[model samples]
Target: MKKKLGAYLTNRKIMATALLALTLALSACGNSGEKANEGSADKETRDITIKIGYQKYGTINILKADGALDKRLSEERNIKIEWIEFPGGPQLLEALNVGSLDLGHTGEAPPIFAQAAGAPLVYLAHEPASPQSEGIIVPKGSPIKSVADLKGKTVVLNKGSNVHYLLVKQLEKAGVDYKDIEVKFLPPADARAAFEKGSVDAWVIWDPFLAAAQTATGGTILVDGTDVVSNHEFYLATRAFAEKYPDIVDILLEEADKIDVWSKDHPQELAEKLSPQLGIDVESLLLAAGRRNYGVQPIDEELIKAQQAIADTFFNLELIPKKLDINDAILK
Candidate 1:
C-alpha cells in the first residue's frame, strides 16, 4: 500500500509541472499580440500634419527647398509636412498671429510689433545677427552721401523691419535724429520699384534685397547694421502649434542647423541652389550671402535683450503704437 501511494504522488507532481508550462506559454502569446497593437498605435500617432510657414530669406527656406528635412523625418517616422510661404517677415508673422500657420520665421522687429498687436506667438529659435546683411543703401551718384544727409529725404523700407533699427542706429551714428528723415514703409518688391523709379531717395533694407539692389541698380551701401546693431532673426510658432507639436520643432531646428552649416561653408554653391527660389542670379546671391549670419541657435536671454533694445528704440521714436516687452513672446 505504501509503494502504491508513492507512485501516485509522483504522477501528480509531473502533471502539475506540465500545467505550469502551458499557462506561461498562453500568457506569452497574449503579451506578444498586445505589443503588436501598441506598435500600430504608435505609428498612427506619428502621422502628423503640421503646417509650417517660411520666407525666402530664412534658413528654413534652404532646408525645405532642398528636401533634407522631409527626407530625413520621413525615413525615421510616419509624418507629412505642409509648407506655406510668404514674401517677408510681416506677412509671414501675420499668418501665424491669425492662427492660420503653425510655425514661422521672421526678423527681430516684426515679432515685437506682432506681439504688441496681441499675436499669440512665441519664440522657438534665434538666428544670430549677420550685421553686414542689412544697411542703408543710396544710389551711386546720389548726393545723400551720409546718414546725416538722409535728412528730409523719403526713405523707402519695410516698416517694423530689422532694417528699421538699422536706420535708427545709422541716424544716431551720423548725429542725425531718428525723426530727421521721412519714412516710407513698403515691402521689398514695392520698395525696389519705388527705389528704382526715384520715388524714394534712399532705401533702408536687408539682403539679399540689399545684395540684389546693390548689384542690379549699383546702389551704394551707406551703412550696415553691423557697425552699431545686430539684426538677429527669429523663428516663432503660434502658442497653439508650439504646444501641440514639440517634436516637430526639434526636427526643424535640427535641419536648420545642417542648412546653416552648409550655407556658411558653401556660400557660392548655396547661392546657386537658392537662385531659382529667390529669382536672382547666383552671382548676385553670393554677394549678399556672405552678409547673412547662418548661425542656428536656441533663443536665450541675450537674444531677448537685443530684441528688446529694438523695441525700446521704436517706442521712443513712436514707430509702434505702444511699449513692448519682448521676452513675453518667447516660448522657451
Candidate 2:
C-alpha cells in the first residue's frame, strides 16, 4: 500500500508539470499571432499615397530627379508618392483646394491669394529669401538706367506675384508713384517677348526665366529685390493632409532640407542636373541656382507678421476679394 501511494503521487506530479508546459506553449503561440497581426495592421494603415504638386524648377524638381523622396517614402516609410506638375503656384494651390494635391511649394504671394479665395491650406515650411533671384530687367545696353526711370514707363509683370510686391516696394523707395507706372500683367513668356521687342520698358521676372532672359536676350537687371522684398518661397499643404499626417509633413520637410544642403554643397552638379531638365543652359542654371538660398524654415511669428503685412498691402490695394487674417492660415 505505501508503494502504490508513492507511485500515484509521482504520476500526479508528472501530469501537473505537463499541463503547465502545455499552457506556456499555447500562450507563446497566442502572443506570436498577436504580434504578427499587429505588424499586418501597421502595414494596412500605411497603404496610402502622398500627392505632391511641383513646378518645372526648384528643390522639388531636383528631388524628383534624384528619386530620393520616392525611395524613402515608398520603401522605408511604406507610403507611395505621386508627382503632379503645375505651371505655377496659383494653379498648384487650385489643385490643393480641389483635393487633387496633398502638398506643394510656391512663392509667398500664392498662399495669400489662396487664403483670400477661401482655400483650406497651411504654410508648412519656407525657403530663405533669395532676393536676387527675381528682378526687373531691361534690354541689354538700354538707356533706362534706374528704378526712377521706370516712372511713367510701361512695365510688364505677373499680376499679384511675389515680384509684384517687389516692384511696388522698389517703386516706393525710388520715389516713383505707383500710379505713375503703367503696369501690364503678363505671364513670363509674354513678358519676355514684350521685353525683347521693347514693347515694355522692363520685365519683372524670376529665375530660371530671369537667368534665361539675361542669357538669351542679354537682359540687364535694373533692380533686384535685395534689401527690398524677401522673395521667400513657401511650402504649403492642404489643411486636411497636414492634420491627418503631420509625420508625413515632417518627412517631406526633412527631405527638402536635405536637398537644400545638397544643392548648396553641389551647385555645379545641380546646375548640370537641372540644365537638361529645365532646358536652360548650364551657365544660366548655375547663375539661377547660385543666387537662390535653399534652406527650409518653420513658420514663426515674425514670418507670419511679414506675411500679414503682405496680406494687408494686397487688401488695401483691393487685390484680394476679402480681408484675410494670415494667422488663421498658419498651421499650429
Candidate 3:
C-alpha cells in the first residue's frame, strides 16, 4: 500500500510539472503574437514622422490652422504630421536641407542657393504667380519714387531671399547700378519698424507685409513683383526623404493645388483668417490676397528659363558663388 501511495505521489508531481510547462509555452506564444501585431500596427500607422514646413500666408495656413490637414492624412495615410514653421524662405529651406525637416516651402531662389551650398535639396513643386506679393515700397510722402529713386537712399530687405534678386533685377531693369543704392539689409519686421520711424526710405519685401506696411505707415507700393519679378514658391525636400515618402509628396502637391484654388475664389475670407496670424490689418491682407494668383504653376522649360535668367544674373554679379543648373534641381 505504501509503495502504491509513493508511486501515485510521483505521478501527481509529473502531471503538475507538465501542466506548468504547457501554460508557460502558451503564454510565450501569446506574447509573440502580440509583439507581431504591435510591429505590424507601427508600420501601418505613422511610424516615421513627416515634418512639414509652413508659412503664415495664403491658404496653406488656413487649412493647417483648422487641423484639417492632420485629419485628412490620418484618414488616408494613417500618419501623424508635424508642422515646423519659419519666418522666411531661406530659414525654412535651411531646415529642410539639413535633414531637420522632411519638406518645406520657399521661394524660387532658395532651392538654387541650397543646391549651390551642396545641400541635398531638390524642388518637388512650384507655387502660382504671386505678382504683387513681393515688391519695393516707400513711405506715403517719401521722396523715393522708383528703383532709380533708391540710387542713393537707404533701402531695407532680407538678404539671400527671393526679394534680393528682385531688388537687383529692378535696378538693372531701371538702368540703375546695384551699388548706386544704399541697401540696408534687414528682415521684414525690422524693416517695417524702420519704414514706420521714417528711418528707411524704401522697403523691398513680400506680402502680406508689403500690404501691411502700405496701410500702417500710410505707405505706398512703389513697385510690386510684376516689375521686379513674379515669385515661384517651391516645395522642396532632401533626395532621400522624397524617395522614402513619394506618396506623401504627391498628397502634399494635390492638397496645395486644392488650397490654392479655394483661396483664389475666396480672397477676403482667406485674408481675414491670415490677418491675426500675420499681425497685419485685415483690410490689407484682404487686398493682398485678392491680388495674389493662387495656384500650382508647375515649373516647365519656360519657367526654368525665367528662373535661369535670375540665376545667371546672380552668378554674373557673383551674388551666388557658382553658376547652377536649374534642371538638375527640379523634380517634375
lDDT of 2 by residue, 1-332 (tens): 22442353355446545754655555567877555554332344277988999876778878887788888888755888899987567788888988899999888887888899889999977888899999999998888999999888999987767788888889989999888999999877778788888888899888888989988888899999999899888889988787766656666766787888899999899989888877789989888988898777767788899999889888887889888898888866
- Global local distance difference test of model 2: 0.81
Which window of ten consecutive residues has the lowest lDDT sum in model 2? 1-10
lDDT of 3: 0.73
Which segments of candidate 3 are over 4 A away from where they belong?
1-45
**Model 2 ranges with Cα > 4 A deviation:** 1-45
Whole-model lDDT per candidate: 0.78, 0.81, 0.73
Q: How far is candidate 2 from the true structure (C-alpha RMSD, Å)?
A: 15.2
What is residue 276's positional error in candidate 3, in angstroms? 3.0
What local lDDT score does residue 155 receive in model 1, on the 0 to 100 scale? Answer: 93
| Candidate 1: C-alpha RMSD after superposition | 15.1
Tell me the tens digit of each residue's lDDT in model 3 across 1-332: 22442353355446545754655555567877555555332233354568888776754566576566677788865778888867777787778767888888877676667777778877765766686788888888877777777888888887777888888878888898988878887767778888888888888888777877777678878887784587877777888876655556656666776777777887777777776766777888886786777665455677778878877888888878999888877754
- Scored against the true structure, residue 146 in model 2 reaches a CA lDDT of 98
